[model samples]
Each structure stands twice: as C-alpha cells, then as structure tokens.
Target: MKYLVMVQGTQLDYEAMRGKASPHSPAWSEQDVQAMYAHMEAINNDLSETGELVDAQGLAEPAKIRTVTLGDDGKAVITDGPYSETKELMAGYWVLECESLERVTEIADRVTRCPQPEGAPNHPVAIRPIQDGAGDLC
Candidate 1:
C-alpha cells in the first residue's frame, strides 16, 4: 500500500526559519536548519535504498500561495496568500510504498522527531492511505 505522510507549518514558522523571529516562534539558527535538512535527507535516502519511496518534496513559503475557490456565480474566485484564519499549512510530504499502515506509522514517528530549535512547537505529522483503485474505497 501507498501512504502519504505530511508535515505542517505556519507562516510564523517559515519566518522563524528564515531568521526572522515572531512572538509565536523563535528564529532558527543556520545550524538548526542544516540539522533538519540532514535529518530529512537521511530518511529519504533510507527509503530510496529500501525501494519504498515513491516521491517526496518540500513546499515553498506559504506567502507565495494563491487560492482558488468557487464563487456563488460558479466562477473561480482567486485569492492570494495562505488562509487568514488557518495557521497551519502542509510544509512537505512523502509518498511511501509500505507493507502496512504500521510501517508508515513508524516513518511518521521518525518525522516527528526531526531536530528543531528548543521551544519549537511539535507539529503533528499526518498519515493517510492512498487508494490505488476503486476497490480500496472504504
């Protein structure tokens, strides 16, 4: 089965990563960022060596987001930037072909353990099964 594992972050988190501290998050040092990158790279490399990785990617800053919504007139309404009300957005994702949900859960657990600055918020890592065909519906 294939599973999608997602990591989330906020605009404030992104700012902190870029060395701008906000009231909500502390600025990340250069070493902090490199540690995180190394951690994620190790995981990806391991998955690739095991032939379990399908795809993986990290997203750009949320400030560059453009949202498209359905208007009352049935037309597309375009909006810029992240949702004003929602702080958390998907920061990255990995698609893994695993033997079972348990295996994917283990991977997600490791993701949650990624290195970060002290006092940094521990965001939840989401895991969902991917449907390959109509038979997978439940």
Candidate 2:
C-alpha cells in the first residue's frame, strides 16, 4: 500500500529561507542557504534511490488555501483558503510505498528528525494509507 506522511507544524517549517539572506542577493553573505536546500534534496534523493518515494514536495503556504463547501443548491462553494483555525497546518508531504504501517512509521521518524528551518519546531506528521481500487499495487 501507499502511504502519505503529512509534515506539518505550528510555525513555518520552511522559515529557514525567510529573512535569511538570499544567495542571489549581493549584500548578503551571512550563511549558506543552499546547503539547507541540499539537505532537503538529499532526503528526496535517498527516497528515490531506495524506490520507496512515490511523490513528494513542499506545499504552498496554507494562507493560499482554497476549500470547497457545499451550498444550499448542492453545488460546491469555493471559499477562501485555510479553513482550519489551528496554527498547526500542513506544510508538506512525502508519499511512500510500504508494505506495513511499521515501515511507514519508521520512515516518518526519519522525516520528523530532519533538520527544519531555524526557529521551527519539529513538525508533526500524520500517516494515512492510500487506497488504490485495483488492489494489486505490488
């Protein structure tokens, strides 16, 4: 089965790039932001090399969220982004192909331990198994 591990946190997990001097900016030579990106990329590469990664990427800021709600007419009403009131919003996700929940949990632990942007706490990840109707996903 395929599982999607949701990586989310209260503070911005990708905040490492914010306020930090950009490599492109001429005035800033404070730190190496590219190294951070490299770390993130390394995780992706590791998953790809192991053939467990199905798909993965960081999500857009939740503020840009758009949710669909049902109107009185039974039609869907498109509302502004981020319906959830909690500060803990989904920030990114990694989809992995695994045979057991334990395996998925192990991978989740690895991701949770990954170094995130400065000032960001370790994000909580939610794991849910995906259902492909065919059932022969081996």
Candidate of highest TM-score: 1
User: Candidate 1: global Cα-lDDT?
Assistant: 0.93
Clashing pairs in 1: none
What do the candidate models score in CA lDDT, each in turn?
A: 0.93, 0.69
| True lDDT of residue 132, candidate 1 | 95
lDDT: worst 10-residue window of model 1: 17-26
lDDT (tens digit, per residue) of candidate 1 on 1-138: 999999999888888988988878789999999999999999999999999999999998899899999999999999999889978999999999999999999999999999999888889999999999998885
Let me know the TM-score candidate 1 reaches against the reference structure. Answer: 0.96
RMSD of 2: 6.1
Error of 2 at 77 (Å): 2.5
